[model samples]
Target: MQLSVTLIIIIVTTLVSISGFSSQKIIDDLIFYPPAVTQQRQWWRFFTCGLIHADFGHLILNMYALYIFGVEVERAFVSIFGKYGNLVYLLMYVSALIVCLLPTYRKHKNNYYYRSLGASGAVSAVVFCFILLFPLRKLGLVFFPVMIPGFIFGTLYLIVSTILERRSSDRINHSAHIWGAIYGIVFLIVAANFFSTYPVLQSFVEDVKGWLASF
Candidate 1:
């Protein structure tokens, strides 16, 4: 079976994440330490850090979300972009890793104790990209069991993430999530405009408008 780009990424991330669980050196080397980037100029940490996770639960959630949204996003990109479909998808995922970390790097460039590891930023980019593609699509929480429009869900997610980021009470980088999601939307809109001539933002608005008319 030919593995898709999404599956390939998941396989590599899972293997590396599992290894990170057993080896502190692996984590230390691959994990995002802003000081490493600022002082040592280890720029690759911006991207490599996303290949490992803090734990199995974190790994699973990020990869699961990636698979759920990535498959569809890949297909959509193909439909809109023709031969460059997979290429654009890959670019978005990889660039999202770096783009999503820029703010974090700025904030923690000298915070020697600051370290982050996970694919959350890239995965958030994928999820938000999918949300833009299908604004009317219904999303349901794992616990709440109530289905809501993708745009609405995305809105709530950004709001909650912003609030949590302000609190700064957790190890998770909520700021990365916020920036990742914003980058996702912007990336898709810009890519569509320049590469495919598709009015993605307009399409999203039309989809939402149609959904609103149904009520």
Candidate 2:
């Protein structure tokens, strides 16, 4: 099999997450702990936290989402940005790890108890980027019976994520999902302006409008 960057990311993330399951040290060192970043200046945690996950289910869900969305987004980036596509793709993933958690870090930097791990934020970034490029594409949850157009899914996702972030006390970082998705769309627009002649934003709007008109 030709090893694309998306495949390599999935493989590396899976291996690291599995290794972390056997070694608490791996989890402790890599998991996002705001206190560590604030007190000890372990800024690398912003990036490394994405390399480990909390459990098998967390790892699988994240990597599975990444695998599905990342390949298409990567391919689109390559077609748009040409030789620099891979670099831009890597930047989107890594930056999403840090940018998506900025709010959490600010709020909990002194809360020694706050901790999180997983690549869900980065995966969200990839998924949103794909949606931006293909707004009319159908997307559905694995267990959900209904499939919806990508733009509608994106809107619903943002609403649900915002609600979950505010009202839910679950350990999941819904904030990251919200911010990561926004970052993905904004990053694509910015990069597209600089790197390619493709009317990224216009195309997205036209695609969504065309889809709406069809209905």
Colliding residue pairs in candidate 1: none
User: Residue-wise lDDT of candidate 2 within 52-133, one digit each (tens)?
Assistant: 9988999889998998899999999999999988889988998999999998899899998889888888899999999999
Candidate 1 at 151: error in angstroms?
0.5
Report the lDDT tens digits of candidate 1 across residue range 52-121.
9988889999999999999999999999899899989999999999999999999999999999889899
TM-score of each predicted structure versus truth: 0.98, 0.97
Specify the poorest-scoring 10-residue window by lDDT in model 1.
Answer: 136-145
lDDT of 2 at 57: 91
The alpha-carbon RMSD values of the candidates against the true structure, listed in the order shown, are 0.9, 1.0
